[model samples]
Target: MNAIIENIDVLLSGFLTTLGLSALAGFTSFFGGLILAGFAISNNPTLRKISMLYVALMQNIPAAAHLFFMIFILPVLGLKAPFFVLAIIGVTIYFSAYYCQAVRSGVNAIGRGQLEASRALGLKNMQTMRLVVLPQGLRNSVPPLINTTIALIKVTAIAGVFGVTELFGTMLQLINVNDSAVIALMLVTGIGYSLITIPAALAAAAVERKVAFNS
Candidate 1:
């Protein structure tokens, strides 16, 4: 307890970094996934194939491998950035694949009747998708999207491997200095993660309820 109190500043800084990384990665992945989902559902065969290939690749690769590639291989190709930036990019891309699938499932859940109704109302394909399909699909996708967001937040700990100094990194540094504090530090770290994920989960549940009621 005293150890945590003494190192509150360090813990807080690390928590803030974790929060920022999760937020940046979460929003970027959400929008990117939407675009990918659009591609997956497009009438154009080439676009569908490209989206399928991307999903296959990202889903098969591990997140740590993605980070390692970003940290090591990208530099060999003359692409370099700060560890924080690289971590963001890695986490975003890693989670976006799952997000794409989640959104795609939601889009698929919409029945043919909805599409036919839109077409009968003189809406073009693009307009029908934009004004009708995507809105409901996104709503239906909230639970899975929230699950992905929670998982991504936890995965931010992997950023420490590349020297990004997020919450897990801070805990590791603290543990090295005071080995006796390991249990306490880990407990605090779990609490910090809970602070973010629990609220997000609650909010998602509320949104899901509202969506169901409206539907």
Candidate 2:
């Protein structure tokens, strides 16, 4: 308790860093996923293949490995950036795959009738996807994407291992020096994570209900 009380500023700073990382990664991943979903549904064979390959590679790789490659491997290739920037890139890429799936699944869930209707109106494949599929699919995807976001936020803890001083990193640093407050430090850190995840989770449910009600 004394340790936490004294190090309140440090804990807050770590929590804020985690928030910043999550926000940047989340927004970019959402955009990337949307674009990839478009690619997946495109008429062009090359675009479809590119989408498939990207999602496959990202999905198969472990998130930590993605970050590790950027943090360690990329520097060797002279593609160096700040460790924090590398972490954002790694997280965005890794989670965008999952977001892509969430979107693709939503698009798939659309009734065949919708596609037929678009075609009957002389809408091209790209136009149908842009004006119809994406709008509907994105709405259906909201809840799942938010759930994915919860998972993403939790996984940001891994970034600490690669040099980001997020909440978990703060806990580690404090525990090493304040062995007696280890349990308290851990509890507080867990609470910090819950503060973000719990509200997002609750909001997911509300959004799900709203979407369902509207549909």
Candidate 3:
């Protein structure tokens, strides 16, 4: 018990580290995904084709391989980022691919007539997308985005394997240093994540329900 207390600061530090990385990556993925979805739905066939290939490449690649490539290949290009940064970049790229698809579906779900009406009212493509289509699409997209955020949180554990000292990394250290208490340490890590994530999930579900009723 005293050892657990002694390690409390380390655990808290690890939890915060994971939280920060998850939040940064989540934001990056959200915006990157939005841009990719826009490109996918653009009028130009060439742009759409490029976007399709981008999604296909990312979706087909295994995430572990992607991370390895990011860590190894990026350094070769003179970008020697820290492990946590690389982790965020890796997960952001992966999550953005899926997010783009989800948001694209939401964009498509909007009726063509509405777009035509906006154009008839002298709205440019940019104006129509910014002021009308995207707003509605975002409402439809949020629930899935929240779910993806939770999944990203879970996936950030993979950062530990790269020597990023997030929650799981610290847990790994603790388990290795004190093998007799592995189960307890794992439970501590699990509970730490649950404390942060459960509320976000519940709030997202509530918002989704509200959007459904309003829609």
Candidate 4:
């Protein structure tokens, strides 16, 4: 407690950075996933294949590998970005694949009957998908999407490896500065993370219940 009080500023700074990175990555991945999901379900075989390949590639590789590739390998190829930008890009790409799968499952859950009915109403494929399918599929996907976002938030800790200065990075610094206070500082870090994740989990549960009731 005393240690935490003394280092409150450092903790808060890192917490806010982590929060911002998670939020940015989450939003980018959500939209990017939606785009990929569309392609995955499209009538065009080529687009579907491309989307599937992307998802498979991302899922097979670990996030740390992706970060290392972006931060270390990309520079060799003459592409460079700040660690902050690279972290967001890396996290977004890594998580977007999971999001794509979650959204694809939701889309697949919509029955062929719904598609047939939409076509029977003289709706084109794009129109039907935009107006009818996406609305319903996205609702079904809310819970899993929320879970994915939560997982991504936790994964931002990995960004510390590239010196992104997020929550885990700050904790490591604190540990180095005051080794004896490790346990106390770690407990406080856990509390800080809980403050974000607990609320997100509760909200996800509420959303799931509401979605289930509506269905």
Candidate 5:
């Protein structure tokens, strides 16, 4: 208790780092995943093939392996990024593959007639995606998108392994120093993460139901 009170600033700083990483990864994955979905559904066979390969490669690569490559291999090739930035970039690429699949399914669920209608209305392909297809597909994808957001928050723990002082990293250090406070620290971290993830999941569920009814 004394240590925790004394280290409140350290713990709060760590928590903020974790939250920022989560938000960065979440927003990038949403937009990047949408772009990947667009590629996957493109009329160009070459673009679709490339998108398929990208998703497959990202999905098959272990997260640790991906992290190691980004932090290790990329630097050797002269592309050095800060730890937090690298972690966010790597996780966004990894998780966005899954989101691509989810969003692709949502896009497919919308009938071809929607695209045809957009085309008939003089909307270009980009305009159709921006104004017609993606909006409806995203509304349909809200549930899965929410699930992915929760998953991304938990996945930010991976940053700890890279020496990023996120909440988990901070907790690990504190527990190691105090030994007896391990359980308490862990409980706090878990509760903190849950506070972020649970509401996101619930909100997604509500939006999904509402979208379904309006469809």
Candidate 6:
């Protein structure tokens, strides 16, 4: 109790850092996924291939490897960034593949009839995708993407291992010196994470229900 009371400010700071990472990564990954989804469905064969290559590479790679490459390897190549920025970059890239798939799943749910109709109406491929496919695809994608975003928030805990001192990292730091309060520290960390995740999970469930109802 004393340890927690004494470290309230530190815990709050780390919580804020976690929030920042989650929010920034979520925002960037959303756009990244959208663009990749677009390319995957494009008329240009090269673009579709590029999209496939990118998604395969990102999806297959371990999340830690992505962060490790950014934080340690990139510096050797003369690319430098703050640890936080690197964390964001790594997380955003890894999750973009997931978002891409979500959006792609949405695109697949779209009827072939509408696609053929678009061409019958003289719309070019891009025009059809932009005007007809993506809007509906994106709408359908919301629930899964929300679920993915929840996962995204949880995965940011890995950032702590890479020296970002986020929520989990803060708990680790506190536990080292306050060894007797280890269980308390763990509970605090779990509660902190649950505060964000529980709500997102509930919201994801709600969105999922709404989407299913509408569909």
In terms of lDDT, model 4 sits at 0.88
Tell me the spans in candidate 4 whose CA falls farther than 4 Å from its real position. Answer: 213-215
Q: Would you give me the overall lDDT of model 2? A: 0.90
Misplaced by over 4 Å in model 2 are 121-127, 213-215
lDDT of 3 by residue, 1-215 (tens): 54456688998999999999999998999888878888897888998988899899997887777778788788999989888889889988998988898888777677788788899999998999888888888777888778878888988888877788999999898878788777788888999999878988998899888777332
Clashing pairs in 5: none
Q: How many residue pairs clash in each candidate?
A: 0, 0, 0, 0, 0, 0
Candidate 2 has a TM-score of: 0.93
Give all candidates' CA lDDT scores.
0.88, 0.90, 0.85, 0.88, 0.85, 0.90
Q: Report the lDDT tens digits of candidate 6 across residue range 1-215.
A: 99999999999999999999999999999889989988898878999999999999998998899999999999999999999999999998999999999989988988888889999999998899789888888777888898899889898998888889889888889999999999998899999999998998898788777666233
Residue-by-residue lDDT tens digits, candidate 1, 57-126: 9978999998998898899999989989998898878888999998988777787888899999999989
Pairs of residues at least 3 apart in sequence or in different chains that clash in candidate 3? none
TM-scores for the candidates? 0.92, 0.93, 0.88, 0.92, 0.86, 0.91
What value does the lDDT take at residue 85 in candidate 4?
91
Off by over 4 Å in 3: 1-3, 72-79, 116-127, 213-215
Superposing all C-alpha atoms, what RMSD in Å does each candidate have to the true structure? Answer: 1.8, 1.8, 2.3, 1.7, 2.7, 1.9
**Runs in model 6 with CA error above 4 Å?**
117-127, 213-215
Query: How much is 26 displaced in model 1, in angstroms?
Result: 1.6
Clashing pairs in 4: none
Per-residue lDDT of model 4, residues 1-215, tens digit only: 67788989999999999999999999999888988988898899999999999999997899999889889888899998899899999988888899999998877778888889999999998999899889889988888888888889888888876789899889998899888899998888788788888888998899888877332
Q: Which stretches of candidate 5 lie over 4 Å from their true place?
A: 76-78, 112-132
Clashes in predicted model 2: 0
